[model samples]
Target: MTTDRISRQDARRNAIIQAARACFRDKGLHGTSMADIAREAQLGPGQIYRCFQNKDAIVEAIIKVIISARVEHMLAVNHDLVRKADEFTRSLAGIAAFDSRDDALLLEISAEATRNPRIAQLVVEADLNLFEQGCAMLKARYPHLDTIQVNALSEVMAVLTEGTLLRRHVRPHRPIDAQCLQSNYLAILHTLFPDTQSNNTRKKD
Candidate 1:
């Protein structure tokens, strides 16, 4: 493409991506259409084509935004929680403020991946990185758990975190109460740091 044409094309592609994000936020992946995104982005249908080939291409962009946003969010952590009490409190607050819309879209995309073998592999590879991060966190806290054991625990934490967050949306009134969520997470954390718990108990005595 010519310089002017390429610049215009790049600008249009950005507009469509921005529009797709807003459309997905408002109407979800299944509900939104390419036309709707084009309208929101203020680009013509033809303009959208010069950028993304299809609606799936746009949906894939949305998925990347959802996953990358949170994955990057996690990497921002740099703190010293001197006690399980502090760590548990942080965990509860973190989970409580998580975006339910993003979670729902991610879950839907994950389910969709199952039908498309290619997408399934990509999704699994992406999630495996998150799992590895969780395992690393647990390993730092509880050095005794071997790699295999830490991996198992990390997977449990992943499942539990997602389950409770979903419950927060599905049953608003019965959402994991802050204390209950902390206590439950603490119970698991204690498994990783029995010495911390024991020392705290002794201090109390």
Candidate 2:
């Protein structure tokens, strides 16, 4: 009820979420238990239950954190891309810097979503939110593009980005060549927006 009490509750909840994320990343969803999370959070089982009803609740919270962070990153990247088409290759490379553990956790979540209705719904909602935001950014930046084209391009971009993340898990030992990724992304950009490419060339000339 008091401000301090609310702050404490918020802090405890966040601590539990962080612990759940780490546990899930290491042991995966099925492998992890509420007891594991409690140990990781340095809290008693009863204390953790005070904040979250069950392991599923903690898992959902972790997913929310991941989605929120990703949406923010996508929005930032979208803003940069709209303002600086010439720097699109650099931006692509920036987004490609993947963390192995995070990628693994994402793969785990994807697999779990196949059987977990709640997680499936959460993933669907997060994806639609991301797609809408991406579409808005693309529509604003390239008003000449028709609605269908904008939607298609946004879907392609999302697929490409997710594919890159998936690759990290598929080939954990492989080194990512930044230049190669940039070149590929630039080619995709040129194919998608040839007019912008020509305009950039003319500006440089």
Candidate 3:
């Protein structure tokens, strides 16, 4: 394909993905259809098909985009560890960064993955990618830590993130204090990265 054609196709695919996200947020994955996405995107159904073979393909693309975003966020956090270590701990405590709608979509997709082999494959692959990238970040920040330690720390981080999201969704009424949450998470971070925490304290002093 020509460069112009590829660019147009890419743009078209992005528009469709954005539209599908809106539809999914409003009507959910199973509730939304190709026609609804087309209407939202202001594109024809044929255009949507040309960009994506079906809704599954579109979901895969959306997941890819979310993963890409998360990778970028991880890189940013890694950078903060080097330059603004104290801020990194505070960032961990701030739960507002995660969008509930996005979490819902991920949970919905995960539920679908149980029944759909293709989606299950995508979830497995995306998770592995995230975990590996997370390990790399930890290794970079705490080079003194061995492979096993870094791997364990990465798993802890993943659990903390996903578990926090689940708790917020499942128990929205049971609100936790912001100060208490920050203090507790800071203690966990200090325990996990003692060297960084000491460095952060020294900088503060």
Clash count list over all predictions: 0, 0, 0
Candidate 1 RMSD to the correct structure: 5.3
Error of 3 at 201 (Å): 14
Please give each candidate's TM-score: 0.67, 0.82, 0.83
Give the per-residue lDDT of model 3 (tens digit) for 1-205: 8999999989999999999999988887778899999999999999999889999999999999988988887787663433233433334444445455777889888887888888899999999999999998877777778999989988987887787666656764544566666566667766666786567789999
lDDT of each: 0.66, 0.75, 0.79
Stretches of candidate 1 exceeding 4 Å from the true structure:
1-14, 78-95, 114-122, 136-145, 172-177, 192-205
Q: RMSD in angstroms, all models?
A: 5.3, 4.1, 4.3
Order of all candidates by lDDT, from best down to worst? 3, 2, 1
- Top-TM-score structure, candidate number: 3
Q: Model 2, 1-205: lDDT tens per residue?
A: 9999999999999999988889998888989999999999999999999999987787778777777777776667664433333343333444433344666777888888998898788778778888898888888888878899989998987876677666544644645666666666667766765677469789999
TM-score of 2: 0.82
Q: Total clashes, candidate 3?
A: 0
Clashes of 2: 0
